[model samples]
Target: MTEQALLLVNLGSPASTEVADVRRYLNQFLMDPYVVDLPWPLRRLLVSMILIKRPEQSAHAYASIWWPEGSPLVVLSQRLTDAVRPYWTEGPVELAMRYGEPSIEQSLVKLAKQGIKQVTFAPLYPQFADSTTTTAITEARRVIREKRLDLTLSILQPFYDQPEYLDALVDSVRPHLTQASDHLLLSFHGLPERHLHKTDPTGSHCLKTTDCCQRAEGAVLASCYRAQCLQSAAAFAERAGLAAGQWSVSFQSRLGRAKWIEPYTEAHLEELAAQGVKKLLVMCPAFVADCIETLEEIGDRGREQFIAAGGEELQLIPCMNTHDSWVQALVTLCRRAPQAL
Candidate 1:
């Protein structure tokens, strides 16, 4: 029997809070064609323009959330990796970042050197998107081909609606919902609308209407990010005993001017505030690890914005980072994943 390895990958963070480090990270992140989805010249020009002042501002945002140990994203991911390692008796477990250090290339090479021929390439994204899942898988394949590594990959599909994943999410966040709150917001990360259509195999099904996601099925549902997100929220709400009106879904972290899935989170905060929801609870189900987006973007800035808009308070339910349930759920998912090559 051949040894089977597990490699967990996440959206990376800047190596440090320094502007230079942030710039490097952002450059690598935004320059990816899957992320920017533009022609080389156009993407380069757009990214270059963004690099001008975005890095300094981004550095400040990262600094606000920077854990003393290092980036919260990386630190928490490593912790999750550590927690899962003890349970994976078949082979070694490694962690990698999509854009930064301990890259997919480096992780694969390390596994190959250890005589591990089969790897379960798990991208820590609940929802499927070209920018996240596809890009990570693409890079792994690219490295395997370009470098001619002998390792074979068994990729884990997005587990957005997996029972184990939903169980972990509900169990982890149930306590937060029990606290006094007027509304619960399931805030998933935003993606450009074009990305959805570009990925739509049906081409005519996605973004067709306000209720299109509910109607999504078969091939469309499998590839639809919005549908998967809505499904995750619906399943979570059902399990948590949240009434339809008690919780609503919103998309966050919109970038550039391109139309993104909405209602936008920032605007939704004000909407909820205006509706006289005095206390609010927000859960970013899209992310399993609490990173700058969750900590600073939502926990910090979002709280200020919500409070200033007449809401009394906004609580950000933390991600299931290294939670015991999540650890076990992840192990189950990995064990059940389809093995390849």
Candidate 2:
């Protein structure tokens, strides 16, 4: 049997939490056109300014979340790769980062040397975003075009609302969602409002108006992160038997001075606390693995803010990292893709 290779790609982290390494990682990550979406010179100027101060701040954030083993994102991804490898009878499994080390090109090259011709590129993002999924796919294609290798490539479509994924998400958080909590907050990472408007086909697709995204369908709003996020929350809520008033959606991890999609998670927490909500359960469905965003921003700072705002318990449910059900879901998704080459 011709061997196939499954390459799982993720948004990467710096090799270490060192300030210099963090700066380098941020420079490479923020410079991508899909990421910053700014003109080169201006982007460089802006990044350089941010790098000067952001790295030390970022390094501190990372240190708070850094696992004894390594970056939680990298460690968990490797664990997922290991778990799925035994199930894939026809292929080898590899992990790649979209922006840091073990890049897409390097992973493909390694697989090629191992006599693997058929390759499947699985962007680990559950939702499809030009910045996340497209960047990874474009890099893989660029490598293929440049090398003129005999490799064939298959990209995994985003499965944000996949039933298997929903099941896994529900299973991951079900244990923590008792009736005691005042409410459940399904928070996702926010994108700039400009990005949604820039990418929307009809321009009116995302008015940021109430219920606007709830009414959108088809490719008209495919690139709208807000729409996908809402859908994911709805799916999980439905499957988890959450009542309408019991759960809500919010966005987090916003950077810069520009306005981003709302309602913001931090603000929402304050509002909930003010509204007499004492205990809360928070879930970051946008992230498949725990990182600085989840660890420090949400788990630590977020929790602290919630308590300070008059809330009692702010319990953070962990992401489905290397969990058996999630691993099985990922392997099943990969197996369904046609073998390339």
User: Candidate 1 — which residues are off by over 4 angstroms?
Assistant: none
RMSD of each: 0.8, 1.5
Model 1 residue 17 lDDT score: 95
Candidate 1 residues 1-341, lDDT tens each? 78889999998999999999999999999999999999999999999999999999999999998989999999999999999999998799999999988798899998988888899999999999999999999999998899888888888889999999999999999888778889999999999999999989988999988899999988999999999999999999999998999999999999889999999999999999999999999999999999998999999999999999999999999999999999999998888778555
Against the correct fold, how does model 1 do in TM-score? 0.99
Residue 26 lDDT (model 1) = 97
lDDT of 1: 0.94
Score candidate 2 by lDDT.
0.87
Task: State residue 232's C-alpha deviation in candidate 2, in Å.
Answer: 0.8
In the range 25-90, model 2's lDDT, one tens digit per residue, is: 999999998888899999999999999899999999999889999888999888888888998777
Pairs that collide, model 2: none
Q: Name the lDDT value of residue 315 in candidate 2.
A: 85
